[model samples]
Target chain A: MTHKRVLSLTLNGKNRQDLVPDNMLLVEYLREVTGNTGTKQGCDGGECGACTVLIDGEPHLSCITLAATVEGRKIETIESLAVNGRMSALQRAFHEKLGTQCGYCTPGMIMASEALLRTEKKPSKDTIRTALGGNICRCTGYVKIIEAVETAAEEVAS
Target chain B: MTEVLPEFRVVRPATAQEAAAAHRDNEGARYLAGGTDLIPNVRRGIGDPDLLIDLGGIADLKKIEVGANGARIGAGVTLAHLAKNAQIAAAYPAVITAAKSIAGPGHRAAGTVGGNVCLDTRCVFYNQSQWWRESNNFCLKYKGDTCHVAPKSTYCHAAYSGDLAPVLLVMGAQVEVTGPEGSRTIALPDLYGEDGQNYLALKRGEFVTAVLLPKDVLPTVYEKMRVRGAIDFPLAGVAVALRRDGDKIGDLKVAVTGTNSRPFIVEGIEELVGGPLSDEVLDKIGDLVQKQVSPMRTTLVAPFGRRRIAAALARRQASALFAG
Candidate 1:
């Protein structure tokens, strides 16, 4: 469709600009243009959360979202979680807790956990479960993932 | 991962009138809302539109105003916002109930109420990849002559599985539509058509601008039957709004979806208008609704199962509303 324009947005705290097609998905734009391959595309149909990203600090499915629709907005991906080769508390907790089996859903799980922790200083197990309900893990049964998030919450609080 | 979208041009208009004007200029133009449904339909080669009018950026279409009369929700209001609005939650919890029931938190963040109200009906035989559909010979909903779900049927039988429309209709909501012609408001139920092939009765280049929900002090509930709790379309769903007069029913509206070609306002609600919802009475009403619903083989659930669940779900929701 006709609205091919110069799409500009803040990506991971950096100003980025690109000419994108009207039908380009946000996930594809992030991976291809921005080179953030950490966001996996498990199901391009939006059934899976592997393509989840924080649009203005809100969890959104990038696979189904059009890049042109989110123009001039702040986007945070899994790549933004770590800084200067040092893992964030949640990432370290995931590593310490071994919250992955096939390692596909880790990025989405961590992103969701990051959002939850930012809003709720200390989220209960049920609150954590409800918040991460959108991000599915096919390999691990989410037991360790939940524990990892809980541990990260404690670590960040302390 | 591109789903192989058809080549189309996008137009982002700042106002509803501008959006409508864009549609007036371009032929075969479609309004792009959240793209949760339209984008996928495009990937499957459903309706080919050369120009798309993007309504996501229009600021005027995203307002949520609650006044003495009722609430006026901009069509562009995201489903996630609706689920989180505290005042709206207290007054119209069923709207949130229906909103949260759809897909997951991520999809809900991207999905919009207008998109759900105008969502395309779905059928297992129709919603597939282009190649997958090609092998099976396309159904009437897309590019074929006959509907595979009901081969002998004259009209398409795609199931209307959206959760919001039935709830909106039950709440006596009115919709404001801006189109190539002009802006006009109509009842929510009037927006639908009987045939799935031409489900929405929207005029060409017309898009829903906002939903006007009248003040409803009555108790309401929405119950949906989906395969998974997190992310799946409804197999069958029921929405009920009730006003009780002491021990008798004062006024009630029961609507159902995910059962037939279009989400329909249950007929024979007059029976429940004045009677008490006793066990025997509710049991009979449930059975009668199932019979009147006449579930078809267009959705994931079997016809018999959907037929049985439709009324039971409605009764359960009704009872819950009363109990609460």
Candidate 2:
């Protein structure tokens, strides 16, 4: 028997209540139910981090996470990073530093960076690399991505 | 290639015994931890379970208790916690090293100690999309008859690639398991079997509750050869725990993973107990690892290469620990 439950969580800083199936993945819940398509589904399931999101301020793969599992947690996606219709520091860095090429991995990368910068105000390049290790970007060879994260970290510190 | 997840009801049990009871009550039910591994395999049409016993709700399965008897790590404790916990890091640096090396940061955040400990074996012939498996007629580990890695052999050759087991094995870890029959604690190595297909020795409704570490601490190191620095499972991982008494080796325990059906301690190391650390001793260690590890064409890397890498890693870690 497939079970359906009303999932109440904070998404993009807004409290939401959605009727979702028990087996529905968080990626599916965000994209299909809540109309938040920012989290991309990459590498079939968990092999890729294109579906990265912040659940209670920690980076997690939404594709492998069940929607019901995060019933009352705060979930931040790519959609949550922007405020007042302006790009966040990380987004601005990525845009200015040419961190994205194909742009498929941008949302997940930015979200993972957002989680890292929340706890680590000024992370070293190696720290940034390790924190964002799960969020892979085939384009830009990660040189620009690391630079973008560094730039954002510098901006935040300044 | 995106595959839709098959429909299944979720059972959120608050305790390990209750979780096991749920599995007993519901036919075709499987225990779900972090779901980092099971979800992907389920998407690939691995199992057709009707229900998932979500153990995440069980508070008992998420605690970390450090006492005189060492640490009792809850099975549901996330890898991220294990990686960052100062007490665990101070007492068992190898544990932190191995935990940090698993998959990617996001996966570590969601992956649990129990989940990684109970990770399913992997093979090139298996772990593919349904259509890909169909084209190859699948392998013995999953749907088909023949073991592609060794066609003449009846047993599967799927390799166990989890990083934590080897390090924990050397630390003399034990696991607390609960089932329909009740709870019992067993040594970590006994939890695994020789056969890759049926690697875990767990009973039908059994699940691990917590991992028990001993109070004794030995200087240990873990290293692995992988295609990438991060997000890649170890091709051949090795862990070494050594106690140096003056110039002689006081005690030593060597364990290996990613080269066999189960992570195991490399036996016959007792002969080196009183011997000084030397080039000959390191060479013998390498030889023992090479002789014991049975790597097959389960991965993209060559069998011989994996075996050599396992031996090399074992020797390297052993030597490094001996030096320190």
> What does the lDDT read for residue A30 in candidate 2?
95
Quote the lDDT for A44 in model 2: 51
Clashing pairs in 2: none
Query: lDDT per residue, candidate 2, B1-324, as tens digits?
Result: 578889999878888888988999988999999998899889889986899999989999889888888999999999998888888988888999999999998898889999999999998888888899989988898889999899999999899999999999999999999999999999999999878999999999999899999998688899999998888888899999999999999999899999999999998887988999899999888988999899899888998999999888878877787788
lDDT of 2 by residue, A17-62 (tens): 9999988999999999999998898885777689999988889999
Regions of model 2 farther than 4 Å from truth: none
Q: For every candidate, what share of the true interface contacts is present?
A: 0.63, 0.83
TM-score winner: 2
Interface RMSD of each: 2.2, 1.2
Q: How far is candidate 1 from the true structure (C-alpha RMSD, Å)?
A: 1.8
- In terms of docking quality, model 2 is high
Off by over 4 Å in 1: A1-4
> lDDT of candidate 2 vs native?
0.90
RMSD of each: 1.8, 1.1
Which TM-score value belongs to model 2? Answer: 0.98
